[model samples]
Target: MAAGNDTRITEPTAAAGRRGVLLGAASLLAGAALPFRRARAQDAKVNMRISWWGSDDRHQRTLKMIKLWESRNPGATMAAQYGGLIGYQDKLSTEFAGRNAPDVMQIADNRESLIASGRLMLLDPYIASGQLNLADANKSVLETVKVGGKLYSIPWGLAGGCFFFDTKVFADTGVELPGLGWNWDDFAAAARKISKAAPKGMYGSADIWAPAGTRAFYPFEFFLRGRGKTAFTEAGKLNFGANELTEWLSFWDGLRREGAVPPAEVTALENGYETSPIIAGRSAMYPINSSIASSLQGLSKNKLVVGTIPSGLGSKALPATQYGAFINTSMQVYVNAATKFPKQSIEFVNMITNDPEFAKIQLMSRGVSLSSKMAALVTPDIAPIEQSMVQMVQYVQEHATPLYVPWPKAGSQIQDLMQRTHQQVAFGQASVAQAVTRFIDEAGQIME
Candidate 1:
C-alpha cells in the first residue's frame, strides 16, 4: 500500500530509484554531434528546468520526484516551473516561439503545433545511443508521437476515454451497471432509466459534451472511429460530414430533452474536475478521460467504477477492436529541441518513465505505463481505482484504434468552435441541423 498511495505520494527508497536509473539502461551519450548548438560535456553539471501544468497533486508529486532525482545524482538540480492549465499552453507557446522553453516539458493539446514549429528536438540520437531504450514501450503508442519518422515526445502513460459510474447510484436506482461492450443505444437507455428512478434533484448522466466542443469531440472521435472512420485524417481534413455530425449532436439533444443529462446550467459549471456533477452527487455517470478516474474517485463519496466507453457495437464488421476509445494524454513529456543539456533531459525523462521505483511513485496518475516493464512494475499492488484505470488502459491499448495525427493550428480553433456549437444545441439555441452546418462550415473555414 505504501507504493500505491496516490494522494500522499511518498517517495520510495531514494537509493532504489537512483540505482534503477543508473543501472536500468545501458550505454552513455556516444557523441556531441547533435542539437542546434553543442551538447553538454558528459560530466558537466546538469541543472534542468522542467515544466508541466497540473493540479496541486501533480505539481507536488512532480516536485518530490525532481527532488528524488537530484538526491540520486548530486549537483544536478532541476528548477521547477509550473502552474494551472488555464494559460499554460499560451505561455509555453510564447516560450517555444522565443526558443526559451524548458529543458523537459509535458506537452498535450499543443503537441502538434509545438512539434511543427521546428523548435522541438528529435529524440532519435538519444534512442540510438541506448540512453533511452523504448523496447518496453507499447509499439502502437510510440508510433503516435513520431513525426516524419522521428520521435520528439514520450508518453507519460497511456489512457483513453471511458465511462466512470457511481456504483452506489446504480445500486440505489436498481439499474444494472453496464458490462464491457455496451453501445450508445444501451448507454442512452440506461441513462434514461436511471434519471427516471433517481432522486428528484439528480440526473442519470452529466452532459459529457458540455461547454468544451473538444470535450464532446473526444467521444465523438471514438464513436466515429468505431464505425471504421476517423474525425480527421493525416492530411487535416474533416473526415466526417454533416450527416454524421448531425447524428452526434442530435443524440445529445435527445438525451437533454429526455432529462437523461443534467441541464445546461449544471453542465456549464463543470469546467473543472472539482465542479464535476459526479463529485457534486448530481449525476451518476460521466464519460471522462480514463486516467483521471482515480483522482476523481478521491473527490467522490461514491464507489466509482470504470467501463468501456460506448461504441458502435451495432456496426457490422467493426475494426479489430470493438472498443472505440484510443489513447489520450500519452502524448506527454518532451525535451525542448534547443536544450543545451539534451543528454541530461533525455535521462530525466527516461528515468521518470522507465525506472521501477519511480513507476511506484508516479503510478498511473498520468496514464497507464506504456512500458512493458513499468506496466508490470506498478500493476502488482496499485490502488483499486488505479487498477480500474490500468484495466481501461489495457483494454484500449489492445482493442481501440491507434489515433495520432500532427494537428495544424486550426485544430484548436475547430475544437473551440465545437464547444460553442455543442453549447448552442444543448441550450436549445440552435437546431441540430443548423449547429452541424455551422460547425462543419466553420471548421472548413478554419482549415482553409
Candidate 2:
C-alpha cells in the first residue's frame, strides 16, 4: 500500500495514552541500574546484566533460570532486563552507544551492523578453547554469527518457516489438504477453490501482502530458491532480476484482489501468528515460522496442522530454513575487549551454551538449542511451546534443505522493501511492474 494509504487500514491502536507513558517510565527504571543497588554492592561477586525481548511467560521462565544459575554458582548475580519487541532495537543501540550495555543481550537479525561497528567481541578464541561447541548447529545459523572467518556468536536455536492450516476448515470447504511437491500455482488454484466453497465468513488464505521478512516474504523466498537464485550475492549485492520479482509480486496481488486472501484492512491489525484472520478462523492457511504453530494452536479452538508452503503449481517441495537463534558476541557474556576477566566470561558463556540443563531451560525462548547434545535433553518439562518447537525442528531437518547464510547487512531493509512492494501491489496503489521497478531501484541503493 502507498505510505499514506496505510492510514485507512486502522493500524493497531497504541496502548492507552496515559497508560503507555506510565509503562514507558516504569520500563526506563526497570531497564536501568538503580534498582540493582543491593546486587551491585557485592563487589566480589560476578554481576552480569542480561536483556532480552519476550512475552511475560518467557520473562518469568528466564528469570527462574537465572536464579538457578546463581544458586549453583554462589557470588554470581544477573540483573534482568526484558521488554516488548517494538522498540527493542532502539533500546539496545542506545545501551551500546552509552557503553552500559548488559553483559548478555539478545541479538536480533541485524548482526552485520553490530559486527562491522566493532561492538562485538570475536568468540573464536573461546570456541577454540572448548568454551562452546557449535559444530552440530545449522550451518546457516553459524554463518549468521560469523564475519570474515571469525566466530562472533553462537546459535541459540533452530527455526524454519512452514505453512499452517486448519485441516477441518479446509475439509469443510471441500479443499484437499496440501501435500508434498505442490507449487504456487497449485496453491493458488486450491485457494480459489477453497474460497468458493468456504463458509461465508471464511477466506481461503490470510493475506500476507507485506514484502519479504514480514511473514508474507517467506513464500516468495521459497519461490526464488526453487528457481535456484539467491536474493543476494556473497558480496551483498541484489541478485534477482526485475521480471522475477514482478511476477512474484503480481501473484500475491492477484490473491488479495480476488478475495482469496484476507483484505489488508483486516491483516493490518495482525502480526505474525497473531493475525486476527487466522486466529479467528476466518482464513484457512498462513505461512509463518514453524515454532509459532504451537502458540497459534493454543489461541484457537480449531485443529491447526503444519505443512510445507506451496511452491509453483505442480513443482516439488522447496523448503527454506527460517530464522535460527544464534549467539551474539555483543549480547551474551562476551569478554569485554579490555576486561581482565575474559576467561571467566568465556567460561560463563560455555556453561550457558553447552550445559544440557541450562540449554533446556533456554529452549525456544532463545530459539532452539544449538547443540545436538542439548537438543536431546528437550523433554516434556520444557514449555509446551518449546516442545512443539522441538518437533517442528525435527520435522524441518527431515524435510527441508539447509538455507544459505543470509546476507548480513541490508537484509532487513531488503525484506522491508519487498513487504512494502507487496502491500502496494495488493492495494492497487501500484502495478506489479511499478512496484518491482521501485523496489529494485531502492534495494540497489540500500545494498550498495
Candidate 3:
C-alpha cells in the first residue's frame, strides 16, 4: 500500500512497535526523525538561535520563514536548532541551566516545565513598547500564556482537539463519517465497525490511551474537561479521584477487548505522524489537533479531514466538550532572559506571529492564523486541509466554555503516569482498579 492508501497499511505493526522503543519526547517534536540545525549568515551582525521541534513540514516552513526574515532584516541572522522528541527537553534544559539557551524557544506539550524555569525573558516589556503587535490578537487567547501577570510566550497559532480520520478508510469500511456532536458511544461503535471491515491485523483505532511521544494529545485530560472535571487542580493536586480515572481507563480497556482498538501486543506507540498507525493505514481514526492539517495530510496519500472530538452534550449531565478559543495553540514561544539580542529575538517572534506575509506563507502549518487579520488573509487561499483546520478552530471558539482549568507544571509528569498505567492495564500487569490507585497515588506525588 502507498503512504496514504487508507484501508491497507503497507508497513506492518511490527515497524511501529519500534517507534516508541526509546524515550521519545512530546508534541513539539511531533514529526522529527533526527536532531539537526542550520546556521544562516554565520557572520551577520546579530546571530540569534531559535530552538523548536516539529514535523518536517513545520521545520521547512519555519526555516523558510526565517530565511525571509533575514532577507528583510539585513544584519540579523538565525540559527535554527530542532529535531524529534528524543532529547529535546533534556537538551533545552541543559542550555537554560548553562545560561546559553536559544534566543527563541518553542516549548510544546511540556511548556510548563520550561516556563517554571524563571529564566525566560518577560514579553510584557516588548508589548508595552509597541515592539510586539497585539492590537488585533485574541485577548482570551493571549491570557492563556501569562503567568503571575507576566507574558512568557506568544502563540504561533491556535488549535483545539479534533479527530483526524482517513476518508478512504471510512469509505472502504462503509462507516459513516462521524457526525457533529458525536459522543463516546457513537465513537466506540464506529471504531468496532471499522475494525471489522478493515484488513486483518488492522484496528478501527490506535490505542489512543497508549503513549504517543513523551506528552501531548492528552485524551484523558480532555475527556474529563468535556464532562466538567479537572484531572489536576491549579495547585497541582489530583482534582477528581480514582472514579474518574477508572471511568476513562475502563472505556479504552473495553475497546481493546472488543477489537475496536489495537491490542497491547500490536498497539504501536505513535512516535510521530510519519510513524503513526493512522498514517500507516493500520488504523482509521487518530485523535489530533487541528493545527496538524498540512503536515499530516502532506505525508499520506489518503484524504484526511479534521472534526470536533466527541462530546457529551445532549447526553451527559456535565459539560460536553473542551473546545476553547485557545486550546494548545499557545504552546508558547519563549525568549531566553539571558540572551544578548533581546530586541532582535522579540522582533523575530513578532514578525512570525504578527506579520501578514509570514502568516500567509506559513498558512495552517503553525496553526489557525494568530490574528483575525491573519485569518482573513489566509482563509480565502488556504488549501482544503487547511480550511478544515480553520473551521475547527472557529467552531471551538464559538462554543467554548469557561469551565476549563489550566493544568499545573506537573501536568507532563501526570501524563507520563497515565501512559504507564495504560501500559500496565493493556499488558494485564494491573487491573483497572489497581491502575487507578497507582495513577492517583503517583499523580499526587507529582503534583506535590
Candidate 4:
C-alpha cells in the first residue's frame, strides 16, 4: 500500500492533550479540581494510561480483565486507548513524541525504533528489586524484550508461525500430511499434486505478504540455515548475497507463475482470514501465525489443520521453530518512563501478564497465553482451537531446528526490505537477482 493512503486511526491523542490542558485550567480557576484534591489528600492514588492495538473482541476482553484488576485494587485506575493493527505503530509514535504515551504500552515484535528512542521503561530495576517476578516467563521470550542488557518489557503471550491447510482437500488429493522432516522438494511435489486435484476455484496455496520482522524473516532465515548460511553474521552484518536471495525469490516466483499460488494482486488485497484466499477455500494452504488460527476457524467452513514449513532440498530437515507461536520476539507490555506511579503500573502489568484470570481473557488475542496456568484455563474454554495451537508448539519444541539469538536493532527494517523485495520479485517488477541486490542495498542503508 502507498504510504500516503495508509489510514491512521489513533484514539484522539489531541483530545487527551486538550483534556489535560482543560484540567489544568480548571485547577487554576477553582484552586483545585475535586479529583486532584482527592488525589493529593488520599494515599497517592495512581491513574495510569494503558494502550494497545487489537480488534473489538480483544478490547472487550482486555477491558474486562482491567476492571477485575481495578476491583481488586481500589486506589488505582487505568485509562485505556486501543486501535486496530494497521495504524497502531504510527499512532504510538505520535503519542510518544507528544509525551502523552500511556504508562503501559504494548510494544510490537519489531520495535527497535521505540527502543532506540528510549521511550520504554527498563524493567531490570523492578525485577532486581523483587517488585516483579519473571521466573515463570519463558527465558527466550524474556531475552527478546531485553535491550542493552536490561529487560524493557514482558511478553503477554506466545505466538508461532505455521501453515494452515484444508485437511479434507489434502486427503482427497491423496497427498500425505506434511511431517516435521518434509523437505522443500516434497512440499513442491505436494503443491503440484494438490493443484491438479483441487477444484476450479481452488489453488494449492495463497501467498502472504512476507512478514517484516521475526514473523516473516525468521522462517526464511531458518530455511537459509539449512542451506548453510545466515542472513547476518555474528557482528550483525549482512552475510548472504544476491545469489542466495535470487534462488529463494525464484522459488516463490516459480510457484506464482506456475499457478500453484495466487498472484500477488489477489494476495496483497487480503489482510486477514475473512478475506484470505485460503480461508475462503480458494486455496488449499496458507502460512500464517498460530494466533490467527482462532480467527480463521469461524471464517473457514472446512476443517483447518496446522503444519510446519517445508525443509530445504537434500539437507537434513531442520524443524524451523514455530516462529509465530513461540513466546520469543512477541508483543510485550512495558512501563512508561514518566509514570508517577511506577509501582502500581508494574503491578497492573503483572496483573495482565501474570494473573491467571486476566491472562485467560487475553487468550489468542495476543497468541496463546504465556502463563501455563492461564493457558490451562483458557484452553478449556476454546478447547479445539487451543489444541491445534498447542500441537504446533509442541512439534516445534521437539522437532524444529535450533533457535537462534533474537535479532538486534534494525531487525524490523531488514524484514521490511525482505517483504518489499518479495513483492517486487513476485510482481515481475524485478528479477530475483535484482530484487535481492536491492534488498541488500536498502537494508544496509537502514542498518547504518
The best candidate in terms of lDDT: 1
lDDT of 3 by residue, 81-119 (tens): 999656788888888778888999877556666667677
Question: Which stretches of model 1 miss by more than 4 angstroms?
Answer: 1-44, 211-214, 315-323, 402-404
Instruction: Give the distance in Å from residue 353's predicted Cα in candidate 4 to where it truly belongs.
Output: 3.2
Candidate 2, which ten residues in sequence have the lowest lDDT sum? 323-332
Per-candidate TM equals 0.85, 0.78, 0.84, 0.81
Clashes of each: 3, 19, 3, 8
RMSD in Å for model 1 = 17.5
Best-first order by lDDT: 1, 3, 4, 2
Predictions in order: lDDT: 0.77, 0.64, 0.74, 0.69
- The total of clashing pairs for model 4 equals 8
For model 1, how does the per-residue alpha-carbon lDDT over 147-214 read when each residue is reduced to its tens digit?
Answer: 76688887876777778889999999999988766778878888899999999868898886644212
Model 1 poorest 10 in a row by lDDT: 315-324
Which one wins by TM-score: 1 or 2? 1
Roughly what TM-score does model 2 have, to 2 decimal places?
0.78
C-alpha RMSD between model 3 and the true structure: 18.2
Model 2: per-residue Cα lDDT over 106-209, one tens digit each: 66556567777887778887667666665665665466445676777665455566567787888787888876455666777778888889877678877665
When sorted by TM-score, best at the front, the candidate numbers are: 1, 3, 4, 2
Q: Is candidate 1 or candidate 3 better by TM-score?
A: 1
